[model samples]
Target chain A: MKVTWSRRHVLETDDWSREEIEHVLDTANGMLEVLSRPIRRAPPLRGRTVILFFAEASTRTRVSFELAAKALSADVVNITATGSSVEKGESLLDTARTLEALGGDVLVIRHGSSGAPYFVAQRVGAAVINAGDGAHAHPTQGLLDAYTLRAKLGDLAGKRIVVVGDVLHSRVARSDINALVPLGARVTLSGPPTLLPAAWRCGDLPSGVGYEPDVDRALDGADGVIALRLQRERQEAGLLPSIREYARTWGLTEPRVATMRPGAPVMHPGPMNEGVEIDAAVAHGARSLIEEQVTNGVAVRMALLYLLIAGGEPRLIVGAEPPTSIAGGEPPATPLPTGVV
Target chain B: MTTFDRRALEAAGYLVVPGFIDLHVHLREPGFEDSETIASGARAALRGGFTTVCAMPNTEPAIDSPGLIAELVARAKAANAARVLPVATITRGRKGKELADLVELAAAGAVAFSDDGSPVDDARLFRSALEYARAADRPVLEHPQDLALSARGVMHEGRVSADLGLPGIPAAAEEAAIARDLALAKLSGARLHLQHVSTARSVELVRRAKADGLAVTCEVTPHHLALTDAWVAGDRTVAWEGRPSPRATPFDASTKVNPPLRTEGDVRALWDALADGTIDAIATDHAPHASVKKDVEYDLAAFGISGLETALPLLLGGVDAGWAALDTVIAALTTGPARVLGIDVPDDDWTVVDRAATWIVTAAGLASKGKNTPLLGRELRGRVVMSVVGGDVRYEGDLRAAPLAVR
Candidate 1:
């Protein structure tokens, strides 16, 4: 299959094609090569400006995107919600437009509201990347996790991966399914009955995914695992009894890790709730890919910025098409009109 | 009443029905004026062929006192289009605790009592309100919802909402609340009107309650009858599939509403209820919110569609599609709603609709201040060409001059 890139927004992963997923993986491999060299820098985006418009607090997503942009030799500016015009009664659209007016060529937004980046992308000419929206998509994170799993396990096809924790509130869980399911991997979500409720399982579990309340049952023979952050507020909201109870029932302990295929690799989109969702020893264990996921995060984002920004030219890449589209076996997408970029 | 020549009216493709009486509408006056004023909402209602519209009481100060009801009555009369009858809040500030003076409010020209936007959750308080309403000779309309159950849900709890990744507001939230309200109404023998029945279970509940001889009635919105949550989850291309266009989230925010649009099964049940006379009336629930309020994310955006200008024609479209007989739908919009609020259906007031005519709904063309309709750009049939209230022509549409003297 030969495909060209011209799209300008990175929102949810629900519509990604297998070919597109592989395309990002292939591109991230190249980015990893660039990161390996001493004094690493890429000049494809040297003259462009990347703006980080974060309306929510973050440590990993913010720093990784900043480093990725800087490594591409692009000028980067960071804006936060508090102590800014956003606090002085400026609307999300107005703030987005103001950033575009300030010569931002790429906008990376992490808003507290879902679909905020999609809203901005429709109005502005700049490239929009959703850093993380409220329980919505986090596309870049989805891509990096897939890349990490593929790198470690060789292929994601036919693999069983259990995503355990507050799948309801985790945007990471949404993104992971979007990325993993299309690649022929079976994903099961496991957590307390409150966090992994019946609604998530019944309506739209995307064909390749299922949910299990028993963490032990879900992790049985699983090839990989992604543990999500469990906010202490869940207990206060009566979704759980207490953090200690959660860790005992649902937390990924070393014993639980042993139940999976040997060296199955555990991953977390980190700032881990160490005792709550995963144990410290398990996080630092031999099968843990937590640190590698952080490293791959930069590579994956670099690949995304390249494809969305630098790969807008009328060049085609020859590759074998993935078996399915992002919507799980939907037909290959209709290409955008010529010279859209 | 002025009678038109039958041949001339038939040549013009016009069908005259008694002017519509809407049982529920949020005029947003005395608060949130930027979204809509009483004058603006009434004019919009008149344009849609409505003669009388019951204004909901969920406002800034709320319509709890006789003085507040009197002020609204005066404001509606001064507006001078559709008659705006006040629906006073059942509780002071709609706090769901203390009951309001229902007797005095009815005397002060409040036709009904309701906390239409917020539910009166307490069973004890709701029972007290219903008992008082019986004495006042007014119906008590309740926006039924188990708040704790529907806590953070943004849309209908179903497959569409699940696919869209929004928190689901289960149908049980409405079913549980209505069950409680019906039990109280049965116990108290009060006139109870269920506001915006959205699910199949709700329609069945209302039907059973009426059969059991309880004084209960319910209204369904045009959007709910015409659309389902599938429309709310429109086609989308995921980000990884390539570049995700802004067009991805097109229907997400606009289709959001209270008692959110349910399933196709529910839509079928509503049509069946309307046809079988189980549902009482068709109300716009014509809630108008400013663009700034609705253009945000689904959870953050207000729950409403500015519906006054589009309701009649949309229901008429349902008629044309064989969803219901024309007369039955007309009754739901006119005499049926008038009876719900005990308003007299005057023979002198009527609107002439061009059943064969078609027009696209647009924000710039509507009389209401709110432009948040989901029906924007839809080419719909059955336009109200001219409306007459109290023998006065309130709205004359483009086809008025081409009339073979429609009214």
Candidate 2:
């Protein structure tokens, strides 16, 4: 099915449809094939500039997005909030405007504030990508998680995926539910009652989403599971007791994985709190898609940058003179060669 | 007081009524003067057909002592547009600890006492303030909120906050504080006026407290009665004047008001309370902040909306929308607030409002220094054609041609 790419900002997955999710997964699969090629680069976004403006410290998302932009032959400029004019009290909009003025084509922003990218997108004509926002959304991470699941277990229709831990502060949990639910996956969130209140389960969240306090009950017969990082501050804030207690109670151990359907992939949007949120034994085990999720993260981000920047409407990306126009290539689009990276 | 040109007023064919008395207005002076001052706020109030407005005591230093109260009164007198009665802080610097000298403040012309902007959370301290305020014959207006329950919450906790992914400040945060303060008000037999009441249960609690013969009177803001969280649910974009941009999405900060705009059901309940006389007044709660303070990200932005210019027109539009009867709306603005403040409202002082006149809201049109209202650019019915305060023509919307000729 032919779908028009209209959205200029990839802020959240809430507005994503089933077809959009499938299209992203398919595009990521194509990009995965491109990753295996000898040259491992595409000319679609050849001269475009993609800025990585991260206010928060991130390893996987930053590097993955950087690699994706580089692989597409776009110039990547990385900026951090610390030791910059941002620290000198420059407002978020001012910084964004400055970057746009400096010829930023597509801005992939990871801000500590929720809706920061949306704020920037409204001000500038450049394409905005929300790499991660505070407890709000991480669309690429969600898409990659979904892609890894789809690649592993085939079609995800009617599958149950259990997302465990710190749902209140987990942007991944929000993005995951937004991405997976519409694709016929019944997602159950499991966490300490304080961390995942009943209030988060309501509102615009999908009807297929449910919550269970018992980790075991949530993981029972789960087709997949995504473990969230538990910040130590939760204990200090009295949201939980101790890390040891959390590990014992909610952590994904090998024993807990055994209760799930055989080879039900375990996932974590990384920099994992190994002992606290997930046991290292299960994380590195054959059934865990931890490494595959990371590998697919690059592919998914490549797909996003490609589709959004390269394949996006030309009117959205301001100021950059493209060397090659991806818009010219449409209608029975050329597929990337299917090879393993 | 300057005398009104009665002959000119007659020539204009304007209807006159008592000057509006706003019980809750944040002049933001003595500190955040960049947003509002005594002169700017009084001018804004006058433009809205208000002659008297009770200024909240949540300034930088707070109107805690008789000295500060005297200073505010003096400043308002110099401003000369409206009567800006100072409301003293309940506690020292509004820290919610150590009661201020309420009797001295009252003697110095403080109309009421409130720890607005920050709630007087401590039950004992608040109760003490109530007891002391009873002696002064001034009501203790509480900005009812349990900070513990509303920790880091940016908007009303419900379906909308859930949808927006912003932390929810549950209705219980206001309801719980209201319930406790009402109980304390009853215990002390002190006059208590709840400021900016925003939830359904809050109205219900206030209604019951009043029924139980408690000296409880509450005021709802015009924004609270007209708008819901849906306005802020998404980007909260408004086409505010100035600044080059066509759209201003306060994102989180734009609509980041305290006791955040509640649900539609709560809006309906506020009108119900107003209709049944359960709610006493419609206060503007015209809190203003500089664009630098408000135009930032949601979590970092200050709480408030500059409502002085838009309050009467919006409520009058509300009447057109069938939100309330015109008489009821008029009573809430004038007599209702006058009763809450326990002041003998002068029957002679009034502003002529053209019920048929329509005007679109604009930042340039507002007399207030702060251009931070949500109603900008929206065409609203009802315009204050001429405002007379203390027999002086303070605001004349059409007095453009003749600078000194009152007509």
If scored against the real structure, what TM-score would every candidate get?
Answer: 0.92, 0.90
Model 2, B1-407: lDDT tens per residue?
33566666555555467788999998988998998999999999988888889998888888888888888889999988888889998888888879999899999999899988888888988888899999999998889898999999888876556655678798899999998999999899999999999988999999898889999999999888877786674533221212232334435465778989888789889988999998889998898888888777777778889888888877775676676787898899889988888888865677776665667878888888888867677677677767777777777786433322221
DockQ score of each predicted structure, in the order shown: 0.36, 0.34
How many clashes show up per model? 4, 2
Residue A257 C-alpha lDDT in model 2: 82
lDDT by residue (tens digit), candidate 1, B43-108: 999889888889998888898999988888899999988988899989988988899888999999
By summed lDDT, the worst window of 10 consecutive residues in model 1 chain B runs over: B236-245
Across A1-341, the per-residue lDDT of candidate 2 in tens digits comes to 45555556788878777877777787787788768889888667766789999988887789999998988788999898775788788998788779878876789999888778878887777888999988778999889989999888888899999999998888899899889887888899888877874465543344788888899988889998999999999999988889889999999999898888988999999889888899889989978899998889998988788776655332222216552455334312324332211
Top model number, lDDT? 1
Clashing pairs in 1: A15-B238, A16-A326, A16-B241, A17-A326
